[model samples]
Target chain A: MDRTIRVLVGKPGLDGHDRGAKVIARSFRDAGMEVIYSGLHRTPEELARMAVEEDVDVVACSILSGAHNTLLPRVVECLKKEKGTEELDVLVLAGGIIPAEDVEFLKANGVDEVFGPGTNTQDIVEYTKTNLKR
Target chain B: MFSGYPGGMVLYLHNQIIQGLCERKRAGLARAVTLVENGSEHARHILEEAYRLRGHSKVIGITGSPGVGKSTLVDSLIGAIRERGDSVGVIAVDPSSPFTGGAILGDRVRVRSRTTDNEVFFRSLASRGYLGGLSRHTGDIITLFDAFGFDYVLVETVGTGQSEVDIMRYAHSVLVVMAPGLGDDIQAIKAGILEIGDVFCVNKADHPDADRAVAVLEAMLGLNRQWQWKPPVVKTVASQGKGVVELLGKIDEHLEFLKQNGLLEERVSRSYIAALEDNIRRDTVDRILTEARLDGTLDLVLTQLSQGKTYPAAVAKQLIGKYLCAEESDNQ
Candidate 1:
């Protein structure tokens, strides 16, 4: 059986701007991956809990509220702290109005990749396919 | 601990998962559900254990058309159930793309109010080409939840049309949610849906036509129906969590009706029958197709089909005879 890569597309924090998240979710679906979308205003704890419960291979955080500096790393930290998720090999990705300089910091803080504005949806899909830890 | 293990290592992980389940760990239940959803080789062992530990939970099926607030209603219902001191497990199903076998499961978005609560566990599923607005392994996952010791297991189906009455086979009480102004009056007259609903909910009651929708559903339900526990229609603004308590009350009343009349056992038996049929199809039809694909028999059949040399019915008969009857004869 072909393993279907499951992704948790989360918009953590008070950002109601989920257009980018929805677009990426559609792209992932079109690429034959299952996307579990966590709707707007989700806390990092909720995202991590959902990722663990859903057993997803990727945790894609879409932050348009410019809180990525604080929120994105907390998502990774919460996932690590979530019960039974310590062993889960999740590829964490961050996207949305992030500055280029902060991309390195995000990656160093457990985000595997950071997609800035104008990043193609297909690139995210291919990146997910290539970078999946499983 | 569940995936990518080899040989005996897989068995060890299965045992570990089972132990975790026995200890009532949330992670164990979550991983077990994933294993069942994936149809892993270890699923049978887990399901066997789950079946042995079943019968503690009430399975409620919530289904309706798209945008009828099924997920929102489920989220509210979860609150109601929790307020009554019952732990609930929610399995929300969404349709997968037929072209790509992928899906966007957005139900969890609406049903995320209880994320911090340990007693509330929500999992989203893709229909995965299974028609009838549900995943193929939905029943098995419900079993896992029941075994995990939840007091209630709520199943939210993919937005369904008229023919998706499959939810009735698994649920003790089927809640058919409808929003106002969806032309649901005419929908109420649809045969398959009207007959299967144990309780009907007209959601988005703040809409001007909410009363009309409820009246239409009641009037349609009253048409020539016998007095054996008539299905009640409740109105609710699910987004605001209004009228949810009444809706849950009506559902509980229906459950009481099922219990008093001994119909709950019938529903249980129906679910078992459905499970048996599903497993038989997996063992027979799925196994046959997989083997045929592996041995190039499917390629030959497709060639014959495209050339108009053999019809589908004839090919099906030949394959069944060769694969099934031949095995029977050999056994004899």
Candidate 2:
């Protein structure tokens, strides 16, 4: 079977501004991937549950509320618990107003890459295409 | 139990998945739905098992135009169903881009209120080139959900226009939601949609013209002439949860009407017919086309047609004769 790339673009904080997430979701869609946008104000648990239920290949979250250090890693931890098995590999990505200093901290946790505000959409697309774990 | 290398592995996985599904594990149900959505070879086995175990859940289809609050209404309905101590599964469909075959499934955003509730399972699907406002495998997925032992299954179609009435073939009750001030009063008079609605809801009832929209829909419903079960039009502001209970009550009444009148069986049989026809098309037309493309016959036909050498109907007849009839005769 020809598998289509499935990505979950989620906002895990109280950030009501979802413009960045919407843009990335659309970019993924235009690149021929199926994107599940988890609206807004999603907790880490909810996002993790959605990723597991949707069986997506990637979990690309956008957070602008400056809670990346606290929330992004929780998303990864919750996803691991939700899957309950390591057979399904998921690529975790973060994008938003994340700072350069915090990128290493996020990667140390579980995030594979971080795209800043001005990062090109195509670059993110390529990054996802190349870094997909499945 | 084909003990061959990969076939054995596949069989093992399938058996494990089916066991989990029978035991009401959400992970198993989720994986089974993915297999069906992806049209995997093992999907046939899963669906066969699902058919044997289904028929407990009520399948409801909610459809409307863009920005009609279908998703919000569905969220409210999920809460209502759960309050009554019943489990529900939701399938929300969005359209895919025709050029790129990509889709952004945002319905989950509006319907994520019940994400923490294990009894409420939600899945999003892209239409994936199916133009009738639904995914191709919607029926199969619904079967999987039903077999997982949910009390209710809600299938929300992509924002629809006139003539996306395929929902009627699969759903026992169809809820047609409309908002006020979208010039939908004229839309209520259209023939295709007016005939398929089992219950009509005028959402965004907080708007000033909400009552007027309700009036228009009722007037249209009155023109049906015969009245075995007249579809009731209820006003709701789905975002605020206003009038949602009444709407759900009306939907339940429709289901009750179907059961009492022996019409539920008819609807089930209609779904069967639709599923049969869909499989036939996939097995015949889609298979032939795929084989033709692989063997370069499609390219040859296109070249011939461009040169005015053959017509479309003649080409179709010839391909069917070559691929379908010849195989039957050879088997004989």
Model 2 residue B11 distance off true place after TM-score fit, in angstroms: 1.9
- Residue-by-residue lDDT tens digits, candidate 2, B152-180: 99999999888898899899999999888
**Winning model by TM-score:** 2
Model 1 over residues B187-210: C-alpha lDDT tens digits? Answer: 678688667888899999998998
> What part of the reference interface contacts, as a 0 to 1 fraction, does candidate 2 reproduce?
0.78
TM-scores vs. true structure, each candidate: 0.93, 0.95
TM match of model 1 to true structure: 0.93
Q: Which ten residues in a row have the lowest lDDT in candidate 1 chain B?
A: B323-332
- Give the per-residue lDDT of model 1 (tens digit) for A1-104: 44788999999999788888998899999999899999999999999889878889999999988889999989888988885455548999988999888988
Where in model 2 is the C-alpha error above 4 Å?
A86-88, B1-7, B184-186, B329-332
Clashing pairs in 2: none
Compute DockQ for each candidate against the true complex: 0.74, 0.80
